[model samples]
Target: MKRFLLFIVFAAFVSPALVSAGESGAEILKARCASCHDLKGPAPATIRQLWKRDAPDLFYAGNKFRREWLVAWLQKPVRIRPAGVNYLRTINSTPTHQEKTKKGRKYDVLWGAVLKPLKHVTLSKQDAGAVADALMDLKPHTALVAGVTLDTSKKVSLDAGEVIFDKVYGCTSCHQIEPGYGGYTGAELYTAGKRLQPAFMLSYIKRPKNWDPKIWMPNLHVSPDDLQKITNYLILLSKEDFSESN
Candidate 1:
């Protein structure tokens, strides 16, 4: 009777601690984030599959984001991509009235839920920290960022960077340098440096399809020198305060 009582006491006190310790950041991810995001990914294999995606793939988030940025973003969830992750669902055909501008050219207009503010589930500071810790544990694409380093030696003025982004590469068509500018389908570029690791930015820009197989971003075949300049430009851009403009 005495031994049984002792065992029961041990189980009651120690088992709960064991269970709590086992309930890690990964469990938090599975419980809360797995519903909307792709926690396990080979990325979308087809355009149809890509269109069906509801949220960004978090499987490689540790490889992609800065931990500080992730914590901040989760606490105050905001729209990073002007168009939702699935732009196919958010975009509409050109309207008749606006089909032809004074230049008599056609253009597609944004429609649906994305035009409104972001509808993500906001987290409390503590929860956000926990979630960020969980997300940082996910690092499936480690090889992609290997040996990649930010080239700080290269220097490009903001104006020169804009020219490269807009004229040389035409990235401005899909990504925004400032709020209310550029296309609606891709992520905002102004904050890319702040949000992403330098290695990740370099790697992803080199080959986006490698990261998300069926993603809409096409390889622009940027040269090595231009790539260095572009990445440096993004870091410079991040330093500028965009609260007033954004």
Candidate 2:
């Protein structure tokens, strides 16, 4: 009965375009996304005075996330939180992923297999390629980093983006910026401003699969204004360095 209820809830949130296992995080989160992920701003804490909470925010997912990872993770969250973000068990941790032995509850996950679900409907090789092209297509806000020279119209601002960058989204963990900012799993993004076509990037941010099939990342609700900001910010970095055709 519980699982049946879960399935019903799952169908409500997942994208109709996505083919699921009929039981995957994509389905669950998509159904219940509004409860935890608020796009208007940083997700609200349960309390008026509280600023932090347990789950990660999804509002700024457009600015972060690798498309391939996002698709797979949604289809099978066994790699993202292992035991599940809500449960915190590491039930599916791969031998290759980072371990929690050193930090107790503070385990750091650096990498995992590109998710491949035995039960779910996955993107075909051709579709996968199209999606990857689309994902690599995202451009962040074209703002000036402290040391980088990413100024296109000279109106881009990274200061206001601090929350979206470091705290609200934790983008620095996977993506890399040139003068600074980066992570391990994703490609370098300092030059994302110049790498992608503005129009293409726009399509991808709005509908990510216009670029790639996700693995470790999940689709988060995004608004148009935020998309413009991230696009502008990425363009700025393009002034310093970037590539879209690759």
Candidate 3:
């Protein structure tokens, strides 16, 4: 009877602290992140809504992001998308024909605010981990990742991966395979392997429209083999040390 009473006392003392720890992170997210991130469900419904999005949707972050990456990134927050979240607001078409390499082809390039360094909220290590934990609890798209799995056997060489990303799918036209080596419209691909869950990457690549119906990324209609290859390539690419040369 005495031991039972002691156990109950310990539980009473510890439960509240555990709850408070989780709540602190959630409260921080509400106070700071809710203003910019979409912690709630259902992505932008219309083109107008999509254009208005100032940050990436975090409603499905639990399923999308790798926890360690989230914790680290939140601490030293940097811009992932070179053109910012809404390229429509940052890109401008130059009037001069010299801006174009081909006749009658005007290129829209990033300008103004996007060209400037990113301004984002930074959190302390403790707070970042707490917030990442809270964010991980917001998973609503579990179904998206349930059936997907990474197939490492399908891995391709870095050169082969580059060929697939650049020539086959033209992903390099939007996403960067290496720093400053691709278009600024999409988020940098170099970090995708470390920052995102492999299953999420596979599912998103399989059908991006399912995640965000109005997202600008077109359905590439990737074959199953290519899907595995691409996902494997991304995972392998993440292991490279780009900092060595830089």
lDDT of 1 by residue, 143-192 (tens): 99989998899889999999998999999989999988898789998999
lDDT tens per residue, model 3, 39-87: 9969998999999898999999999999999999988887899999999
lDDT (tens digit, per residue) of candidate 2 on 1-246? 999999988877775545433434433444545465543343343443123333444544444455655554444433232223222222334655546674554344533232332223345444444434443333342231122222235344766554455565566665665533455445455645434455545555556533333323344444556656666766665565333432
Superior by TM-score: candidate 1 or candidate 2: 1
Model 1, position 225, has a per-residue lDDT of: 86
Window of ten residues with lowest summed lDDT in model 1: 16-25
Overall lDDT per candidate, in order of appearance:
0.86, 0.46, 0.87
In Å, residue 189's CA in model 3 sits off its true spot by: 0.3
Taking all chains together, the TM-score of candidate 2 against the true structure is: 0.35
